[model samples]
Target: MTSHYDWRGGREAMMRFGLADAPVVVIAPPPFEEANRLRALMATVARGLARQGLAAVIPDLPGTGESLTDIAATRLADWRDAFAAANEAAGPVRLIASVRAGALFDGGQGAVGHWRLTPQDGSRLLRELVRTRIAGLREDGREASSATLTEIARNDGIELSGHWFTPALFGDLEEAAPLPAHPLRTVRLDGDAQPADHRLAAAPLWRRAEPGNDLELAQLVADDIADWMRTCLGG
Candidate 1:
């Protein structure tokens, strides 16, 4: 079902699953383009959780999804506060399930536990965006590098892909890292060498050129979350 939650900025849309009174898992989706790629997978996971008798919500942060806010004006702090507010509105939220860059703002919500899938730091994300921009410029017979684009971003702002990133947002991202929450469980795909509590054997859906769904991977993720939530709830 679709619901709305009011934050300090304004109200934003969110998708809810399962019974209204059940313990909830608030999902913090990956930032920007990655979010679009994984939307289907996230929805599938949310529904799977519902089948396990748990509630879940996927909120649209300030400048993302169906939000009315301007992306160029949104900052990292705004996203963090908005995420915290969303969690408060989702009744009885027991945990947060975040993917990639989503982990950066999953804290400050007071959730008992956090489950992240291949969490990524802001610097790395920024670099990826910069690289993409440079690639586009090269195809047009133009010259630009990460350092040059970053300098432009610092002085004014830069448009990477379709999003306009403000100087403040770029600066914030340069120093942002995923919050180290207590009782956190990090999961990664099999090929990733990064340390994780668990690793699944599935291709990264976010890497696909188009949005896709992986029912098998979604089920694995949902089951892991259900088991983790049970442990966190002392069951």
Candidate 2:
């Protein structure tokens, strides 16, 4: 049975399955458009894990997914703390963190089971962050000049949306550490293991579109999660 519970500045919604005592898979969601895009995939993976005798909790971190916080007020530390709280609620947890969320495991934080999909390149992510911030400002009817954008990027106290953009978040992100030295399994995008250090557990990258359009990327992400659970849980 799937149920919802309020948790740490947010609500934790989860589905339970099989032996009431099974270990849990707590899924930490990705961010922004990616979260919506990957929702189905996360659900599929949760269900798949449940079928295999593992319970799963897929919560919308404090600000995302019907939670109290919106995109603007959601900060990186808030997400990290949310994951930790979710793990506590789920009991001994194996975490499936996707995209940018994968970075949370860097400092050996609340990690039990770790899995990542399409791990982001942190530097590129920062660049894209700038673009996103600028575009968001424009969309909000705020005049965004190149100078303004540069100033925002340089400052750590600027408010984008409602959250304070801090240099610490960017620094930690840029330093993208190795998956906390713990037992971790990963599946990468459709490419050979570029990171020679960690061998990818799965190589197939599912597609939601025929051959183009990034909008279809969500389908691929969802499929990837579903496939990973099916293979890992033998469901």
Candidate 3:
């Protein structure tokens, strides 16, 4: 079902699935372009969770998804606060499921447990975006270096891909890292060297050049989340 939640900024859309009285799992989607790439897969996972009798919600944070907020005006703090507000509205959220950069803001929701998939820090995400921007510039016969772009972002803000990021948002992202939450379960792709509570053999959908879906991977994620929720809920 589609619903809206009100935060200090305003109302944003949220998609809910599964039994209304079931345990709730709030999904914090990956930021920016990765969010687009992973959208279908996330929705699939939500549906799978629904089939397992878990209520899953994916909220549209301010400046992302179908939101009225201007991207340039949004700060990381706004996302965190909005996510917390969304959690409050989601009705006793038992777990937070976050992927990649989503981990950065998932902690403020106060869920009983957090499940992260290959969580990434802001600096690395910025670097990847800068590289993509530089590549686009090179293709356009313009030149820009990472250091120069970083300086520009720090002072005057900058546009990456299609999103306009303010200096405050840029600075916030540069220093942002995933917050530590108790009963955290980290999942990574099989080959990733990062520490994770579990590793699954699945391709990184967020890195794809085009948006796609993998039902198998989504089912795996849903199953893992179901198990984690069971443990977190003492079931």
Candidate 4:
């Protein structure tokens, strides 16, 4: 359920929870359409964590979810601010974030799913996201005609989920980063060259999902989270 509480002097923080005293964890939702696709997985993680004696807070950062804020008005600073508030309300918690939000670690713990690409690469990824979305919308179905895919990949005004995305959104997403060099066990989803920015360790939680995987990917994520909590807090 949803409840409002004073976070940092009457800021009126709104959040959903599974239970209290379960080693609070904040699960950051993904961006755009993936947010919709991954809602089930996100909730699964939260509930799984709760079952393992961990409290989970899954808040819609400023512009997302049931947040009363507009997406257009949300800035990077605002996101970080919301994170800080969530951390405060939840108390010294480990973050289970998706996409850019995973970059918040202090580079001290093992990061599960995260990436750090340059602005150009990030922009490219955003454009590809736009392209895939447009392709998904066409009557031709998910398998876009090569020509249409190429065209969307190359230019502006590409439709994303039935709406045109301006260059501005891509520009902003490009500059975003989850600063802090937290100790990590990163799962590079795209198979990009490993970076020296964060240490490499085994990350089974974020490996590719097959047609009939043994355990649900979200459950694996939750398991790793519980492991982290145990290691850090003698649970």
Spell out the clash pairs found in candidate 3: none
Each model's lDDT comes to: 0.92, 0.53, 0.91, 0.51
Candidate 2, residue 202: how far the Cα is off, in Å? 10
* TM-scores for candidates 1 onward, in order: 0.97, 0.61, 0.97, 0.64
Q: What's model 1's TM-score?
A: 0.97
Worst 10 residues of 4 by lDDT: 111-120
Per model, state how many residue pairs clash.
0, 4, 0, 12
Mind giving the per-residue lDDT tens digits that candidate 4 earns over 148-198?
A: 643543454344543344444444555655565333334442345645333
Q: Which stretches of candidate 3 lie over 4 Å from their true place?
A: none
lDDT, candidate 4, residue 27? Answer: 58
lDDT at residue 82 of model 4 (Cα atoms): 70
Model 2 alpha-carbon drift over 4 Å, by segment: 1-19, 70-73, 93-100, 105-112, 121-123, 132-150, 153-179, 196-235
lDDT of 1 by residue, 70-183 (tens): 888899999999998989899865799899999999975568788999999999999988998998999999999899899999999989868889999999999999988889
Q: Kindly report which residue stretches of model 1 are placed more than 4 angstroms away from their true locations once superposed.
A: none
The local distance difference test score of model 4 is 0.51
Cα displacement (angstroms), candidate 4, residue 135, comes to: 2.4
User: Candidate 4: where are CA atoms >4 Å away?
Assistant: 5-15, 92-96, 99-125, 133-159, 162-168, 188-215
Residue 221 local lDDT, model 3: 98
Model 1 shows how many backbone clashes?
0
Global fold similarity of model 3 (TM-score): 0.97
